[model samples]
Target: MAASVIELSDVSVVRDGNTILDSLSWQVADDQRWVILGPNGAGKTTLLQVASASIHPSHGSAEVLGSKLGAVDVFELRPRIGFASTAMARRIPRDETVLNSVMTAAYSVTGRWNEEYENLDVRRAQRVLAEWKLSALEDRKFGDLSDGEQKRVQIARAVMTDPELLLLDEPAASLDLGAREELLQLLSGYASAPSAPAIVMVTHHVEEIPAGFTHALLLADGAITAQGPVDEVITAENLGETFGLNLSVTRENGRFAARAA
Candidate 1:
C-alpha cells in the first residue's frame, strides 16, 4: 500500500471565536493527485495550511509526511513540502530574476541574498526551469513576466527542492482561457509523471482541473460534501449540493466542466 502523505483526523480550526474548519478528516496517498473544490471562504486554504505543516489544527490530530504536526518542528518539516500560493508570491522581490527566484527555493527563502549555492544547485534549478518550459525566460525579471509565465515560475520554484508533497492554492485562478489551458496542460504533464510527488491543488472551478488528477474533495461551509475518486466525487448531484445550486457536470477525456442547470 502507498504511504499516506497527509492524514487529518477530526481536525478543526477556529479563529477569533469562529469555526473555520469543522471536524474534517482526510487522507492522501503518495501516489494520488487531488483537486479541492470549494466556494470562497470554505477553508480550502486553511486545509492546505494544515497539510503543509504551516498551521496546527485547533482540535484533533494532524500528520504530514509521517510526522505529527504538534510534535514536529515545522521549520524542519517545511522543506520537505512544496507550497505555492498568492500569499507566497507576494514575498518574492519584484527585481529577482526568474532563475534566482527558483534557486532561492533551495534555501526556502523568497529572494536571493548572500546564500551560497553549489554548481549542482544551479544545474538543478536550470533543469526544473526547462521542465516547466521557462528556460528561455530564466534571465527575465519575475515581475516582468506575463501572468501565465509567473504562474509557471511559481510552480517551478515549488518543485525546485524536489519535495515529497506539493500543495497549490488556486494556481489557475484569474487566468485567461488560453493561459488557463496552457497552465493546465503543463500541470497535467507534471502530475502524470511517475516520479512526481503527491499533489493537492485548490480551485473554485471544476473546469480548471487538469487531466491526470485521480481524486476530488468538495468542501462547503467548512465541511466536506464528498470525496473519493475523481469520477465519482465530481458529479452534478455532488456539485449542486456543494454549491447550493443546481449544477450540470460533464466529464469527457478526463476533464471536468460544470454549469448552472
Candidate 2:
C-alpha cells in the first residue's frame, strides 16, 4: 500500500471560542488526488493550511509525511509540501519577472535578490514553467500577466521545489469559462502524471474538478459531511447536504459537473 502523506486525527481549529474545524479526521495516501468541496466559511482553506504546515490545529493530532505537527521542524518540512493560494499570490511582488518568481520558490523566498542560483536550480525552474505552459511568459512581469497566466505561474512556482505534496486553494476561482477549462486541462495532465505528487485542491464548484482526481471530502460548517472515493462521495445526496441545496451531480470522461435538480 502507498504511504500516507497526510493524516489528521480528531483535528480541530478554534478561534475566539468558535471552531473552524471540528474533529476532522482524514488521510491522504501517496499519489492520490483529492478534492475538497465546501461552501464559504466551511474551513477548506484552513484544512489546506494545516496540510501545508502553515497552521497548527488547536486540538488533536495532524501529521504530514510522517512528521507530526508540533513535534517537528516546520521550516524543514515546508519545502516538501507545496502550497498555492490567492492570498499568497497577492503577497508576491508584482514587479518581479515570472521566471524570477518561480526560481525564488526553491529557496522559499519572494521578490528579487542579488543572490545567484545554481544552474540546476535555474533549469528546474524553467522546466516547471514549461510544464505549466508558462515558458512563453517567463520574462513578463508577474503583475502584468492575465489572471489565467498568473495562476499558472503561481502553480509552477509552488511545484518548482518538487514537493511531495501539492495543495491548491481554489485554483479555478475567478477564471472565465475558457480560462477555467484550460486550467482544468493542465491540472488533469498533472494529476495523471505517473510522477505527480499527492494533490489536494479546495474548490466550491464541481466543474472545476480535474479528470484524474481520485477521492473527495465535502465540508460544511467547519466539519466533514462526507468523504470517500470520488464516485461514492461526490454524489447528489452528499453535495446537497454539504451545500444545503438540491444538487444533481454528473460525471463524464472522469470529470464532474453539477446542477440544481
For residues 75-173, could you state the per-residue lDDT of candidate 1 as single tens digits?
999999999998888898989999999999999999999999999999999999999999999999999999888999999999999999999999998
lDDT of 2 by residue, 188-234 (tens): 99999989999999999998989989999999999999998998999
Candidate 1 regions off by >4 Å? none
Worst 10 residues of 1 by lDDT: 250-259
Instruction: Give lDDT for model 2.
Output: 0.93
Q: Candidate 1 at 84: error in angstroms? A: 0.7
TM-score of each: 0.99, 0.98
